[model samples]
Target: MMFKTDKQTLTDLNVLDWNSASLLRFFDHTLTLGGRDQLYNYLMHPLTTIEEIVERQETIAYLSTVNVSKLFDKYMMVDLERYLNKPAAPSVKNRTSYFLDTISFNFFSLSAQREQLLVRQSVREIAMLFTALQDIVAEAKSSGKAVGLLRIYADFFSANASVFDKEEMRQVGRGKSWRLTTHKYNYLFRGKRRPQVQELFNMIYTLDALTAVAKMWNEGGLCFPRVNTNDTAAALLRIEGLYNLALDNPVKNDIHIPSAQNIWFLTGANMTGKSTLLKSIGICIHLAHVGFPVPAQSMETILFKGLMTSINLLDNIGSGYSHFYAEVMRLKTMGEIMTVDNPVVIMLDEIFKGTNYQDAYEATLNFINSISGIESSLFFVSTHITDLGEIVGMDSCVALKHLETKADPKQGAIFTYKLLDGIATEKLGMWFLNRESVFETFRAVQPRKSSS
Candidate 1:
């Protein structure tokens, strides 16, 4: 089955966005278009089985250190599929045709030149990719490392290495003058070679994607999360020293949720880094599932079937849905998913804020009670409802955590962004209002003396 997640979940996790600071962009160091597409595909559909996840993690771990040379220059690989898949162009066949073409080929020269350039690039990239794969295989064998995925790739290249080593193809691919030879040109441009060309691009992209992932792994000091897949009746999700990858200087937090605990109710004053913490956990879960290294000192979790989020929600003005109704709809959606037997991780920030205090509290409380009993699900919900925490904390399935704030009469509120046990009672909204002199501004307004 496809990895179960929606657009809103992706948005809430900040996973994919081209023009913004997204998780995908954060790790996107692809060297070619094919590699980028491959990366996107993997990110979109995370692995479900522990074996698959382990296989990928093993691949990434091994490749991260392998000093594979740069396969091609920056953005050197273009959209060559269209050119390669097209029918082979008519060429100057023999000496007689060559002479005729020299005098009268001007009409088709421009198009042919473009086509020739594309073909030459295709040949060069294919050759380079072949050589790189060969080297990778040799290294793996020589090192005597048990690399599952890399060995598969190496074997694949070994089977196809002859395609790149043919005397005619090799000379032409290397840009020797033999590329202009009619026979060699025809052989390289044969329509039959389209599949090979496509495969070569894919292999190159695979390398690029691996390299890019390795770059992130090294730069972020990331670690592979230990995935739990035993059929036992226990659930566990824990991370040590976790931090947000997008932050310049991120505060690290530890999360420990035993099998009995499902709900993590976070309470903190505004701007206490509650949302950032939620995002950090969400991102860690996502990257873990994708088999990519996560920005944490260490992490371990039971393999969840999917992920759901209700953060950064917005009302639909065009649909006539109020913010409260929109939030209700989101919860309802999660409620439907809860029926599935598969385990899932759910996050809700500032739950039920769209409605009044009483209604929001009741709704959030009821929702928490209902989902807390679900042993197959995990939750991280943040809210300003400190009163509800006392009641919710009583449930064995729920854990109450908060971000503490230090307030000084002169300094206003100083946020430590540290996660701690128990609910927070700091209502610093008034403090900020007072610090801003909101009431003083009204008092300072001059009585309309001039108008009077």
Candidate 2:
């Protein structure tokens, strides 16, 4: 099964983008371009099955315990990749053919000699890379850590045993007999064993990507989430100490969403961390689906078919849709998605904020009531309209939650950035306005009279 998610959801969670603080950027420590591309592919298409996710998690966990830094270098890998991708030259038949070609290339054709030189350099790099991988495999086997993905890689080396022979590679490294040996190995690698060489390159790139993720796991102290496979019971997502990875020092919050109480009616004062909380939850869910370690102490969740978020939704000016209309369309999209039987996670940060208070309140209230009946999915709808809390509070399926904030005489509104039960009653919009002296600024700036 493929995991479902749209561009808007990814953008809302900052999962992948050109931004420096994107989740992809945070985990992208790859050395080679191939490794980076593989990492990008992994983030773009998250795994759906529990078995696949667990296997990837195990691979990353195993990698975290090993030293992969010595196996690859950026420049050497780049050169080897380039050389392998280039078209192979015509094969030399025998010693006579190689001798003639070498004489002709050296004396008559500068380009041919340069090409041969480049081929020799590429061969040398490949030999070095094979030697490095062989050493790593030897160490892993000696230490009895060659299992799982490592074992698979080791088996590949074994299958191509002649290609990574210790004495032969050492000979290739020393440049003992350049003309015959270089052309021979080059033909063997780039011509006869092209497919195997390509496969080896792919494996190394994948290992590089996984090793980067493992490094992130070690540095960030991230943990692999427990994917609950019990389908007999209701779906649940329980995350403890969840925080946004984009923030340097983010305040952690715990979240619980059971199928029994699927809808979370979130309310809070402006800028009190409601949107941040929603983004953090969305990011964790996304990372968990990708089989990457999440920025949380612990997490347990049933597999979800999709995850959608409308945190920073924008209006379609070119399409002639107002902000309110766009918001309605987004919700309509979510409603259609919820029609499916599979479970999903939907997050709407400050829904209906583009419209007037009365319309927003009525729409939010009705929407909450409608989605609350969706027991298959989880809903997190945040709103500035605290009045709807009273009506939604009555629904047993809706969990009333808010980011806690306190008012201080000296400090004004003190944002705790903490998630707590119950709705926020304080209206701090006017307090913020007064604090910023907006009214005073307006009064101070009088309209200029036209000179007649």
lDDT of 1 by residue, 1-452 (tens): 65567889888888887755787797788877778888888787788888888888887777777776467444556645565556664464554554354346454688867755665666555555555566676788679764757777667766765555555444554667354453344354444455666676676777778678888887766999999863653447889999988888888988888877878999998889988898899889988999889989999988888888988899999999999999989888877876763688889999989989999889888888777677757888899989998799899888889997986777868898999999999998888888889999999998776764
Q: List the residue pairs that clash in candidate 1.
A: none
TM-scores, one per candidate: 0.87, 0.90
**Alpha carbon lDDT of residue 3, candidate 1?**
55
* Span of ten consecutive residues with least summed lDDT in model 1: 182-191
Highest-TM-score candidate: 2
Q: Which stretches of candidate 2 lie over 4 Å from their true place?
A: 91-108, 138-144, 162-167, 173-179, 230-235, 447-452
Give me candidate 1's TM-score against the actual structure: 0.87
Q: On a 0 to 100 scale, what is the lDDT of residue 288 in model 1? A: 91
Q: lDDT for each of the candidates? A: 0.77, 0.83
Compared with the true structure, what per-residue lDDT tens digits does model 2 show for residues 19-54?
898987898999888888899899888888887888
